[model samples]
Target: MSLGILVAVGGVEFEPSLLRVAEAADIYVVRRCVDVADLLATAASGQAQVAVVSAQLRGLDAEVVAQLADSAVAVVGVTADTLSADEALLRRLGISSVEASDDVSAMAEAIREAVREPVRSQPEFGENGPGEAATSAEEGTPPGRIIAVWGPTGAPGRSVVSLSLSAELARLGAPTLLIDADVYGGSIAPMLGILDESSGLLAAARAANLGALDAAGLAVHARQIAANLQVLTGLPRADRWTEVKAVLFRTLLAVARRAHAFTVIDCGFNLELDEEISYDTAAPRRNGATLEALGSADVVVVVGAADPVGLTRLIRGVNEVMAAVPGMVPHVLVNRARSGLGWSAQEVTQMVVRATGLATVRLLPDDPAACDRALVHGQTLSECAPDAKLTRSFSALAADIAGVPALHARRRSRLGRT
Candidate 1:
């Protein structure tokens, strides 16, 4: 019996010729799809074992290729250009078997061969290890670092930390990207005083799902908040979490790593893998976005409230995150540290270390007034209250994360005390 084949080469003159020779090669054209959607539908029927697609097919991306592969259909990408400039792009998009020639017989043979071989998995993009510098594709410079700010339940101030850290990093002369990956509620836009009419995270997710998102595409969705800082807002509603798939979320982070000098994510609090509730292994998980961000981050800044109740949740939460992601050593940041707690930073540090085995611990002073001012103005602490003690701490924390000298504090001293 002839092997089944699906062809979706739009407007290619040689497609008719290729189809004529299919019978001789022991393959039959099962369907001639007009577009990617039709192609996917036909492939899902399991009637086709191979799909011949044009490199210029609309909406053709790695995600689509993955779907075809999932349906047990081998994809053979064809480009009209003899020089095969499109071949590199197709390969980058995860199509391994490609035919650059217009010769009908050669195309048929390529299809036959693609069916014989196992479909190879897409090559992982952005191979730079966590915290390692990536070579930017557009510019030959090293890409940015990624820092994830996460915390336990009961409002430990993850969003505030993420906003301040990103602002501080950008203020220090590094181009920064702040991402709101919190699946539950993303307050980055509102915290930064931007309208949340359009969620940048959802737009980017849609683009990634269509395999159309690149660094430039990401820029289109991100809103410019500061001279050097840009933000990708999160889901507009909590229930929209299912729209952001974990695999595509990872791809988005990879693009982010190359686009900015520092990418800070405000992650959701929940650490549950949701495997127990996930009857469909492929279904989206509520915590998938948070898990992916933590896994991709070079630095995970775990925030905890300084009070006793907060500390208990913090210690337990820290252990949970560490268990969820092995080899993850997070930086413990105790927020709203008060002298009234009957413990010094050292004591709190010791307690956290003893419980979680994480050594790095820093404290942010309890400055409700400064926090209120910043929040009221919808600005970062550094912007509204540069001289506030909390602002200095934030600057110092950003410096530690970015491996640079303290920024705003030094600038203030050089200009003389106000």
Candidate 2:
């Protein structure tokens, strides 16, 4: 029987050790300088049956994970720490074994076992192949309106805006679906006080990979949050970004529209590229899930904080959004707006207009108490503090979006007619 081939990923620290282990195990070892991009390239080249990667390698992205998944290569992650959330994320991305103790010989044995085992394939969600284009019926089904709430790097209260806006829309009798598309870090489930083990994105990505993600399959995985609201949470693991691609996201939106009346996506900050690229040629680049979501959104809500740094990020983020998503008219929502450090709402709006040449549409007050309470309770603003200022503001925003006329004015008009 032929000895399995092993690829040492990450830096040169383990090269000599790996070679010795390979000799002892009677296996051929190839040392590849592992970076995210390089790792993906190596996997794509099909040169090695097993990959041993360092946990410390930066830019460990989803595309690399997906590449490994598609290649059926057994991956073993080496870390300095014993166990951590980061290690758990690596395992979620399909790395079969994690060696944190740096046991080079044991790592060799693990690699051999990984190569000997049958490559595990993700379960098919439906009949289509993964990453395939949507069919005509699926495309025409009107999945739902994708309302994406995005903002600059600083804390602009994306999760707050997302939850509040979704709740408000639901109150207006619009069946709403809230999706945590913030691939970097999303707090929807935590904020809602729901311990969601499954993220709709994972199921969608898996279906996309198998070309099986259709309208029917999306309904199966989506979790209903309320009578009029559903949510698709972000990936449980950051490395799972591999399964999600631009094509899959587009399909997800399409399917979402067909199932629900409205779909609200809490997209991540940073819209520069599909993924973050590395200064090093060897490191893998970050995937473009955020950018893709922004591009496909019907309405993009640009949020910013009341502080200087927040304002700066907001201005820069606006320009970036415009550049990447051409013809996307954004609605600016200034979060935590208050008279701070001699800056008023009017002054903030003026500065924003001057900097980005865009107009501000709405402002949300700083209601930290209400927000914290709601998040802790895993309840919406409507349930926790419907009378709160931020809640009312979000309700107004929803009314505007839904085109509902003012209550007193409508009543008066009816009286006049009578």
Candidate 3:
């Protein structure tokens, strides 16, 4: 069998020997990687069978190794100083074995073995996947439902809806955790009267990077706002995206899902991809956390304002999400819905239905007084405006997420006489 290999070993002295030996061993060199990032991008394409990478490769960690292995690419580390440095640290990352680059015999054997070994048959959400049995069993909670609340760049109330939905879910007796995953700018803590400067998401990310974040560790960082509601604050500054890596962010969200019945993320607005495409460096995308949340979410709530410009943005944003994310049923919510704009809800409904082809649409009435009051007091809309129409709308959202019927649904049922 012709084994495809991507070589990114350290030092120029080893490159010629690796290339020559790989050819001698019947291995076909698919790509010669310049750095760890290059190796990872190539490996994820599912073409390469094995990666002979350097043990001292910068940014080489368990998560990176796991991602490569997930793509069915077994990693083999080649190092000149394997005798001095402990191999145990790298072993945990699924490296088949570490061999001295000078020892051509051992290096060839390791590469050959990795190429011949059958890739493990595992689901995408393996033991570490979101809400998998291996993790939920330990947490003692029901399989959690993940909801990602996203909007466009104009700030159409993503945080408010996220917080109110979480609060209402907790009020309905489901343990809920609200995550401020807005890598652009997070306002969940200050909106909820949380004064703690410590960021729960950042702390969780650090622990996840070290492979130390678990259910108990997650529980410790989560700030309890109510009996069944918890909040994980986001980055205090937009520049703190460096602290939260994408892989670690996914792991943190998975752990959070295991610990709660419902995990609602107040996601950021941007969905643009990093276009630089570097072979030697990992370009930082400010919206990595947002993308991660959307990819993992079981349900996504797309919110927009009811005005002309807002609706236009809403339609464009929905199309972007539909084109970008697959396997998700998006629910579009037209917030601040009223008749002052000379277009009725019925007309707006038709426009959205024609534009996005989504059947699930909700119209939340425009109520500035109640929303402003809730924002000023740092309380959930359900708390300060108990009898407000907007609060009722948010409660309807929570009930829908919980798979239960609310007054709105009941009223609609009565009207339809179904």
Best by TM-score: 1
Point out where model 2 deviates above 4 Å.
1-143, 274-287, 406-418
Q: Tell me the lDDT of model 2 at 224.
A: 69
Best-performing candidate as measured by lDDT: 1
Candidate 3 lDDT by residue in tens digits, 130-210: 222224434343668899999998889888889878888877777788999998888998887778679999988876654
lDDT for model 3? 0.76
lDDT of each: 0.79, 0.67, 0.76
Question: What is the TM-score (0 to 1) of candidate 3?
Answer: 0.74
- The Cα RMSD in angstroms, rounded to one decimal, for candidate 3 relative to the true structure is 7.5
lDDT of 2: 0.67
Candidate 3 displacement at residue 200 in angstroms: 1.0
Ranking by TM-score: 1, 3, 2
lDDT of 2 by residue, 279-361 (tens): 33332334356776777788888888878888888878888888888998788887898765578778877888888777555
Sliding window of 10 residues with minimal summed lDDT for model 2: 409-418
Clashes of each: 0, 28, 0
Better of 1 and 3 by lDDT: 1
Candidate 3 Cα outliers beyond 4 Å, as residue runs: 1-60, 63-73, 76-142, 276-282, 407-418
TM-score of each: 0.79, 0.63, 0.74
Model 1: residues >4 Å from true position, as ranges?
A: 1-52, 55-62, 68-75, 82-93, 101-138, 275-277, 407-409, 412-418
Tell how far residue 223 is off in model 1, in angstroms: 2.1
